[model samples]
Target: MKNLFTAIFILLLIVSCLSQSTIQYIYNPPENIKDGLDVGTLAEVNIDSSLIIKAVNKIYGGRYKEVHSMLIFKDNKLVFEEYFSGHKYKWDGDNHYGELVTWDRNMPHHIMSATKSISSACIGIAIEKGFIESVHQSIFDYLPEYQHLNSDGKDKITIEHLLTMTSGLEWDEWGAPLSSSNNDLVGLWVHCEDPINCILERPLLDDPGTSYTYSGGNMVVLGEIIRTATKMKIDEFSKKYLFEPLGVDSSTWAQKFDNGVIYAGGGLIITPRDMVKFGVTFLNNGDWNGKQIISEQWVEKCTTEYRNNKGINIPGQASGRHGYSYSWWLKSYPKSGKKIDMFNAGGWGGQEIMIIPELNTVVVFTGGNYLSDVRVFNILEEYILPAIN
Candidate 1:
């Protein structure tokens, strides 16, 4: 009996140690600041002095109450950073809606559609390294298992269409419990014996690349493409190529797939700081600490406006003006009596990486407003933008 008790105690100790080790692996922070700049507390430059106070007041006035995290970087320096109420250090439980409910500053938040932008970055890197032949290559080439898709126009789908949200696949962007196509995809991903085959069975709604349709299915297909091209899982590829180099370590950086295939569309969960690092990498034109993570050509192409759907009514629109790039949103900011070039990687529920190249600025926000007021953009335009200048 004594020997058995000792053995059980040793096994318990081993299990405890393993659990702690896994947690440490997931949430490890950088040993030190990479640039030696505390991005949370950099001084703001007064580009337009008049707009400064007004912008600060607007943000502080509780207009965007659900905005939990905000960070600003200007001229390659950290400017302003803050965390608000409804924010916690980590998500502890799933909400009644079945969404994860962590809000900690150090905890990785659900980036929502911002995952699309990050996934695009992975594709860019793959193309740069010759892992992917070209963006023009048909996605079916990578996932030949999908080549048997019988839906008309499905064979014509290419990487370009998937990246640009122009595959014309019958999918709904909004994950309404009753109406969203994404919910169906999620169900299929969870239950299907062959997930890629299930996704390939989605019907094509229109001619590929001719019309734009926001579809998470498009990104899911891209995830499969990445899997085929690298001959490795997406999570492993991101950790080796993107996250580790950028000094981002997240415990929740995983896909829910059985094979741990990282969802290229929206499965990543990264902290606000890590998300800022991603923005800075892009703001630096894909260079991380003098290493070119992605080519400048790809960055320009990914951020530049590729499609214009006039008067399209989408969420996060200011005056209903919006444009789409390769997994990025293009917005023209009016400053100093001129329209400045700005683009953002935005996610549902107020997650954003707003970049203004002319001003050399980037603003990031992460929030829990999954089904709240859609006024964050107004707060950004009216308050955040003005404060930075």
Candidate 2:
């Protein structure tokens, strides 16, 4: 018995040591910009080295293991970048099983629903270029073909309602598990013939702009509106205005078409570095370096709390308290007893693009923990935020 106990103890020790080593792995970013944004060390950006190491250790040890990559930008330079290897196909109920996936600085990582935020940016650009009239314009105005579907308060829906997620469409993406047959998003993807028409035909649960309903379908409608107004496919339009201007050519969007109309609700895949570039552009108030890709007013309108949705709780969030603003999720992080306002472009399977305007920091995290509790935000609160001096 004694010998057996000793053997067991030794095995545990070995496992613990191996885990520690993995956690201790350091990510050294480039010393200078060769083709993209400038890079620097964590310490150079006022982040504590020991604290960040400890944070990475927790991430490597905990359920955060699915994290593919994490990037931090502060003081206008890339500070920290880390990537991991995990399963690429992590759907909870789907039969699609993929091989092992390893991410690096160059590879594009799936951002899932974070694409909604990107879609919002596309709308901002469309508005700037006068392709779309304004957020106040009725959505039916853009889709005259779908005007026949409009009735009984549906015509009251505006572009702003779609962006703020207050279209009051009867979407249950949050209320039901993604694996459930009743999940509205899954139902739309699997069964709906015309996603835009299906969403527009949804009976209004409440008047437009009266209540907040977390719906990806609203973005689908907005995407079509952008396409109609600009007369360009979303991929082509985004490439010419957004991606090409940012010098990002490696990104891909999973655009689907039904009867010649495009759906841009989600499935935007890009590198963690490129995601940070998008966040930094918002941090710079719609300016990409010198050019105003999106107007400053659009940036403010989207990030700010346009309407309060405190009662609607996100499924896996422990806090269960979040606000919505133009496809972005708004939350206040308690850093050293101070409430730091943070906005993020979040997605299914743990993808996040968080921006802290007060700290002038942008953080990008990609993972494969689909439909599971993502504790990445806690790591940010416990390690990243505290490390900032």
- TM-score, candidate 1, is 0.80
lDDT of each: 0.69, 0.82
In candidate 2, which residue ranges exceed 4 Å CA deviation? Answer: 1-23, 31-33, 90-97, 255-261
Instruction: Give the TM-scores of the predictions, in the order they appear.
Output: 0.80, 0.92
Tens digit per residue, CA lDDT, model 2, 158-277: 999999989988888877776665888777767788888788888889988988878878888888888789888788899999999998887787657556555577778788888988
Question: In model 1, what lDDT does residue 180 have?
Answer: 35
Could you tell me which 10 consecutive residues in candidate 2 have the lowest summed lDDT?
89-98
Clashing residue pairs found in predicted model 2: none
Which candidate leads the pack in TM-score?
A: 2
| Segments in model 1 whose C-alpha atoms lie over 4 Å from true places | 1-44, 47-61, 87-105, 175-193, 258-260, 308-311, 316-319
Per-residue CA lDDT of candidate 1, range 1-389, in tens? 99999999999999997775444111122223553334433333553434433443444455565677766677756656556556432223332134334345566777877888888988998888889999998777898665668457676878988888888777664445412334665565656666667667777777877787677767777877888999866777778888888877772545566755556777578988788778888888998778888789889987776755333456543435777888888778775688877778887667888888777787888876654554666766676666654
RMSD (Cα, Å) of candidate 1?
Answer: 12.6
